[model samples]
Target: QLDDDLVSALKGALSGSLEALILGLMKSTAQYDASELKASMKGLGTDEETLIEIVCSRNNEELAEIKRVYRDMFKKDLEKDVAGDTSGNFAKLLLALVQTRRDEPSNVVDYEKIDEDARALYEAGVKRKGTDVVTWIEIMSQRSVPHLQKVFERYKSYSPYDMKESIRKEVKGDLEKSFLTLVECFENRQLYFASRLNEAMKSKGAKEKVVTRIIVSRCEVDLIKIRTEFKKHFKRSLYQTITEHTKGDYQKALLSLCGGDD
Candidate 1:
């Protein structure tokens, strides 16, 4: 009771700006993610990659918090902004993700449902004349991770090809990439981050922004796993990649977060 009273008194005493900073310091990961997303989209040219990374990486609960914090910080609906800034299937995918309506995780894996969903995807893509993008979007957006994992596994046996190959054969352009990234994240989030880091570092001139975003955002989450995946996939340490690609305080900071190369 006394602690609550003292906190209230401090809140009353402190300036709004100071209080806001203090609050920000105490904000949750979802809130921080929301703020980062808002900043990425606020400028003249949108940071589309950042927007996609954030939206695709977060789960339904985290996305709900992001939506709330985004509205509080920007005074604009995130969905509307995303719609306005992006177009076509990419926009659709982002909007679907922002809905935060995916199924809750379940301990029991429903094989029947997985087989059905896998067949749905197969019919929508490889088995059809044209891709049934809506079916893909709906399933990808709504299904739980465990459910999707089963779906992908079932897809391999149900069809002659892997899910990624099916996607590759069916769609082209940013939409295809978006769906593939979603699948990758669902399968293994740490590997997805590792892949993004590799892409950022490998790109010409190097995407410093992407590198910074991944390292900063993931440092507290599964960065250790990401580092291991990086080494496994790339055969080079993420720390070494950062060291070779970046210089000065920037390199030092990234290496510090990486906690040395494996």
Candidate 2:
């Protein structure tokens, strides 16, 4: 076990991106997520991207734990914080996610319901003059991932645009981004993380916080898959990308956490 005093000492000794990475790595996953949520909502403005990514991507059990940890650590309700920080349809979608109401992944896929949902999504967005944000939120939030996958697949037949394109046409701003993130996560979560990592590294200087959060958060879960997807999609390994984008202890730490090349 990592000693709390020792961790505090290390935190005191270290600074900058390296310290952030190291400290983030040391927290329990739920604790890390809770802290990230708090940080996103801190101070002048909310980091809505972080809020969307964390809230929309996590499964029910994980979100439940994160919400609990958020209250315990910050003495603030995660739902209230989210609701307070956001408004309109975006807030509604995020609050729904925070409720942790998503159905679990299961082998059993209901094709009948899946088709119905696909049609519903089509009518709500592509088929209608105005977007039905309520239907979009309900289906996206409450349905199982497997069910959603099939629904998105079936949705292609009903509408000229796929689910993502439909979202783009239907909404704008944070809501659009959040829905897109949710769909991407449902489609291929590892690929979603890989894309996030790539986006972080695409510019001249790395977005170190985003890089650290995804690498550290998903390290134990699905990083190997993320590495493979990164290589396949971006034509460069995550290991190499990190090497090119970062240096010193921060680089070394990320490389080690990356495990190895694809």
Candidate 3:
């Protein structure tokens, strides 16, 4: 169920700012004036921070309705306005928010990434030079787990050794362990990740990397949902999982994102 507090916040009024009123819009337009923005944002009064939360936080359908309203009211395009209005990670996150589809296009993989992952496994084993333990962790943590599933299948075909086992042999130190957990737990995630993370954290400073990726991403939208899945798959509490694995401010931010006890 949706949190009642968030639901109430969703129902909250807007201020004069474009960001503030846009959430309430069933549809919107580029042609809208300060007055419409005024009426939308007025009583409650909104600002950029609030807009970032609403726009970047909500999913595509909700954002789409707001876009529709913007078009109807202003008679201008929403994408162009958003394109003009935002940039960088905030913009990227917002666009990802707008692009609610999470499925990998079947053709997206083709043969390259498959070959790349396999070649990485067969050759150097680490896939570094930009491809490294950190990169693999981020991809697994952020992208669809199912996509990771496909990569694993391709990897199995590429080398005689299993990908995770190859990483264990090729990569050294905590880095190897981290990537191993990501791949090993990909299939039975809920059953393994938290414990694997705890095991992975046994090495020095390893937890820090995991904390930083999650905390720094500003991935408010759908992030908790990911955590929930992580927990469900790992058969462990995400909070207890993180706490057992990390320490300090980075852990705090990640726990917050996971909606966990800090």
For every model in order, what is the number of clashing pairs?
A: 0, 0, 23
How much is the lDDT of residue 244 in candidate 3? 73
Q: After TM-score superposition, what is the CA distance of residue 225 in candidate 1 from its true location, in Å?
A: 1.6
Candidate 1: segments with Cα more than 4 A from true spot = 1-28, 43-45
For model 2, how does the per-residue alpha-carbon lDDT over 1-262 read when each residue is reduced to its tens digit?
A: 4578878898899999999889998888899989998999998899988888899888888899999998999898999988888899999999998888888888877888999999999999999999999999999999998899899999999999999999999899999999999999999989999999999988778999899899878887789999999999999899999999999999999999999887
> CA shift at 127, candidate 3, in angstroms?
15
Cα lDDT tens digits for candidate 3, 1-262: 3554653565564322222223323222322222233233334343433344234333334455666666666676555554455554334444454444434335464466656645554544433343344344334444445566767777777667677777666655434444554465456533343343444555675544333323333233344555566566666666777677666654554566566542
Off by over 4 Å in 3: 1-120, 123-151, 174-222, 239-262
**Candidate numbers, best TM-score first, in rank order:** 2, 1, 3
Worst 10 residues of 3 by lDDT: 26-35
Ranking by lDDT: 2, 1, 3
In candidate 2, position 112 carries an lDDT of 88
Best by lDDT: 2
Please, what are the lDDT tens digits per residue for candidate 1 over residues 34-86? 77777777768877667878888888877887888888877888899889888
Tell me the whole-model lDDT of each prediction, alpha carbons only. Answer: 0.81, 0.91, 0.47
